[model samples]
Target chain A: MKRLTGFWAFTLLLVLLPIVFPDNYYVTVVGGTALMNAILAVGLNLLMGYAGQISLGHAAFFGIGAYASAILTTRYGWNPWPAMSAGLALTGVLAFLVARPILRLKGHYLAMATLGLGIIVHIILVQTEGLTGGPDGLSDIPGLAIFGWAVDSDLRWYIVMAVTLLLVLWLALNIIASRSGRALRALHGSEIAAEMMGIDTTATKTGVFVIAALSASLAGSLFAHQQSFISPDSFSFFFSIELVTMVVLGGMASTFGAIFGAVVLTFLPELLVVFEDYEVMIFGAILMLMMIFLPQGLFVSGQQLLRRLLARRATGTAKEGSHGAA
Target chain B: MNIRKTLSALAMGTLLGLGALHQALAAEPIKIGSFLAVTGPASFLGDPELKTLQMYVDEINGKGGVDGRQIELVHYDTGGSPKKAVNFVKRLIQKDKVDVIVGGSTSGSTLAVMPLVAKARIPFISLAGSVKIVVPPQKWTFKMPHTDAMAAAKIFGDMKKRGITKVALISGSGGFGKSGRAQSLKLAPQYGIEIVADESYGKKDTDMTAQLAKIRDSGAQAILNFGFGTGPAIVTKNVRQLGIDLPLYQSHGVASKKFIELAGDAAEGVRLPAAALLVADQLPDSDPQKPVLLAYKNKFEAKYGPVSTFGGHAYDGLFIALEAIDRANSTDKEKVRDEIEKTKGFIGTGGIYNMSPQDHLGLDLSAFKMLEIRNGDWTIVE
Candidate 1:
């Protein structure tokens, strides 16, 4: 009941913030991009934070989803929503198939394999110009529709993205509290221990991997529709790095942490306009400082402070009660 | 607790202060936003553009700026990624409230920003040369460099004039290379020539001997290699190593001296069509592009040391944009866009640009001069 109230409160705030925005530009530029980053980060958190699997090439799946929907809708004259569904299904199936051999590798080996996968995807996108529009990228992607109403405005798109994000978050939180979630945590702690406990480690890992890919695909689809265009360069190696940064900067194991991290990282560069030349340098420095000072993450730091304050309040209340009794 | 309060206060204060500064800055300057690939693989293109833009801005400001308002260039590094490019352009339009935007070093980055600029009704001038930059024609978008198709047509036409009937082709499998190949093939028959041999290699592949050997064994009189950057250099080096001494016709992309440096002695006699900036010494004094070329060459070499045709495009792009702003007499984006579209015989470093609504690409084949590397120096081949 408490979690449900909190979730409603959060959703209400997100939905109402755009109403107070001074201009449509603000909602579209800052709010829209934040929502997009949130989708990517939350999806990635499932793999890195929950499944204990790191994929540096998750953007490849995102790119595949974008290109799939784009090509299908634009070339074959299919509806955008159905094409998006097909894209998500295709990415999920692909992830499920590749997860077995890929998830077997651990640590740096896994990182390199994922990196190679992203590079190969990028190369193929660039090489196959006839279908994918080559380096110039595909333009004129159709907007999202429900029933008969088309979502064209930034506010409308933000609502779509935020609702999608909330749905995914709800699903993810549920999974985290479920039996499979416990198995994933065990596998993350120790594969040998998880196996000894009779947990199907491989199946769990593959299941979570497909889920993460689906989330990325869905986000990519949303991104494509919002931007009204798609390009291979949109899903480059750097985007993968940014997504990873969001997962880490947000407390790795916390859902709220993902949202906080996505918002900060998305808005930080825009707010620091005067220091534009040193933007990347400052971003790197902040990441380093956070890693050193608050190793757990910004979310964990905030949580620790909140806990300490609450503890002090309880202690003061107990002291007052004891004094009155005496 | 006091320290925590103080830190939070400091953070809030800094944020407010920065926001206030941006607001103040916004009111005073004619904000021009630029999206450049400033810190990635394509930084090779963006770094020069940034330097050129800085130089132009400084020069304009020294002359009291346009209409007595200082020019402020707000640049964002897209890192050569289209998604970053789109995000940067959106921020530029919505957040920075820029009057005009310019500089997309790569074709992918340029095309990504086209729709946003159009939707926002802001003027955009692209420095990249992909034909698609102007295709389907967004009202606000314009390209400074000649397209790949035009470059191919000029080169192939010249080859036909020189009686080079059977030409061997070598290209990379990348977008730029593939586009060049397509244009060359499409335009080949028009020039009454045939592709005697065609071979391709991956962009990152270091070995080109097998591809070059195939081209060498085809018994072609000349080889037309359509590639840029390191790929062309490798092809040149490999072709020399294979002892194939036929006339080597390179695409305009390899006009840079870096190609000669990379190809070493093997770069001699490589022919390509380039702007007058590459071989400024050979251009006649009466030529209309001479003064513009001289000024750009002098300023660019002083600022960046040795100007290439790429930088020449940057110089021309900046000059054309400034000229349009001056002609418009106001910072109104729509007016400036219209002024730019109606540009006729606007003397620039590359050539006289005559832009039209149907033609967003200002320059054409006539803007380029055929040049070859002779004794490690760019010289007119004719």
Candidate 2:
């Protein structure tokens, strides 16, 4: 019940943000981008933090979703909603097909395999000029519409993205609190032990992987519709690395932490834009400082500090009461 | 309690900072908003472009600004992502509320923000190269660089004059390369030139010997390389090492001296269509572009170390906008858009910009000077 209230508060904050900013660029434009990255980070956290599988090619799934929707709607003249759904389905299937062999790999081996997949996908997107429009990428993609109303403006996208992010967080929280979520935690703790304990490690791992890929696909579809344009450059090995950085920086296992991290990473560069040539330098320095100060991740350390403080206060009062009775 | 305070304080600080950043200037100057890839994969193009914009803004402002209103430039580094470019465009339009927008360093970035400017009805002067940015006439967008088709036409026209009927085509896997290759292939037959061999290399590929070896054996009379960045230099070096004596024709992308330095001894006699600013030292004073090119070259190199034709694109964008501002005699966006479209015989860094209702880029074939490298420098071919 408390968690539900917190979720509502987060949603309420998101809902009221635009009202406070009132048609400002930060709320409408940068806020939309932050929400999209948050969705991707939250999905990635499930696999990396919960299932304990590393994927260096999340951007490939993102690219798949983007390109799939872009091609389907623009080329075949399908409606935006159906095209996005088709993209999501195709991404889920692709994830399943690759997860079995890939999940068997462990540690750096898995990371390398995923990285290779990302590169191969990016290369294919670049080489397939007739379909992907070569490196320039496809344009003139139509925006998403609900019923007869078009979601064209940035302010509208901000509202849509905020609602979607909160919903994804709620789903993640429920999954984490469920029986399967316990199984995921057990496997994350010790996969061999989980297998010995009659847990279907392969099935659970593959399920989470597909779920993560689906989330990424949905985010990508929304991204394609929102921007109405995409290119191979947007989904590169570097972007995958960025996704991983967001997850780790925000506290990989924490859902809200993922959101926090995404918000920070997305806004940091936008904030640094005023710095001109010093932007990259300052951004790198700030990130380095954050990592050094909070080695366990930003949100994780903050929560740990709060817990320690509360525990110390509780124990102090209890000791005082015993001493007074004595 | 302490952490919560800190978090709130940080948030407050950021909001305050942004507020201060967006505070309107006291003098009521005309704002020129720009977004470029100042840091990223395309920084090679954007860095010089940024330098040019900054230099010109300062110079114009020093002269009491255009129309007696100090030019206040609100520029952002897009980092070469269309997404980032779009965000910056919104910030510039909504928050800064600039009078006109003057930058887009890549074709993709420009295209991404095209709908925004069109909807906002703001006069946008694009520095990126892409025919789609202006085609179908988006009502308020203008470009400075020659379109890919124009550059290809220039190259093929030269090929026709030299009686070269068969040529080998090599391009990179980039937007510029892909567009250039398509234009050349589409127009080759009309120029009576046949592309006997076609090859492509990745952007990161350091070697092109394999591709050149195939071209050497393809019975081609010449090689036409269509690409920007380090790929062209690699092709040039590969051709020289293979001892292929056929004439090598390069796209306008390699007009900068960086290409010559990268290709070293192999750069000599490589012909490419380039803006007159590149060979400004060699052009006669009678040339329309000579004086403007020399002035920009002198001022820009003095301040920014070195100059390139890519930076000249930004120069053209600003001055053309300035010309419109001067003609309109007001900061109204619609008037500026109309006046910019009325621009003709305006000689700036890129070329003589002649904007029309049908054509956004006003340059003709004369804008590009056929230049060949000699003694590690750009020299006019004639």
Maximum-lDDT candidate: 2
Q: Pick the candidate with the highest TM-score.
A: 2
Q: Per-residue alpha-carbon lDDT of model 2 for B1-382, expressed as tens digits? A: 9999999999999999886676554457889999998888888888999899888899889989976788989999888988788888989898889999999999889888887888788999998888777777678888998888888888888888888999999999888898899888998998989999999998889999999999999999999999988999999999999999999999988887789889999998899998888888889878988888888898888887778888989988988898899899998999999999999899988788787999888889888888888899887875
RMSD of 1: 4.2
Q: Per-prediction DockQ, in order?
A: 0.53, 0.64
TM-score of chain B of each: 0.90, 0.91
Model 1 misplaced regions, further than 4 Å? A4-6, A22-27, A317-326, B1-29
- Model 2 alpha-carbon drift over 4 Å, by segment: A310-316, A319-326, B1-27
For candidate 1, give the lDDT of residue A50: 73
So what's the TM-score on candidate 1?
A: 0.93
Candidate 1, residues B28-106: lDDT per residue as tens digits? 6778888888888888788878888888898899998877778888888877877778878877887778888878888
Q: Give Cα distance to truth, residue B12, candidate 1, Å.
A: 12
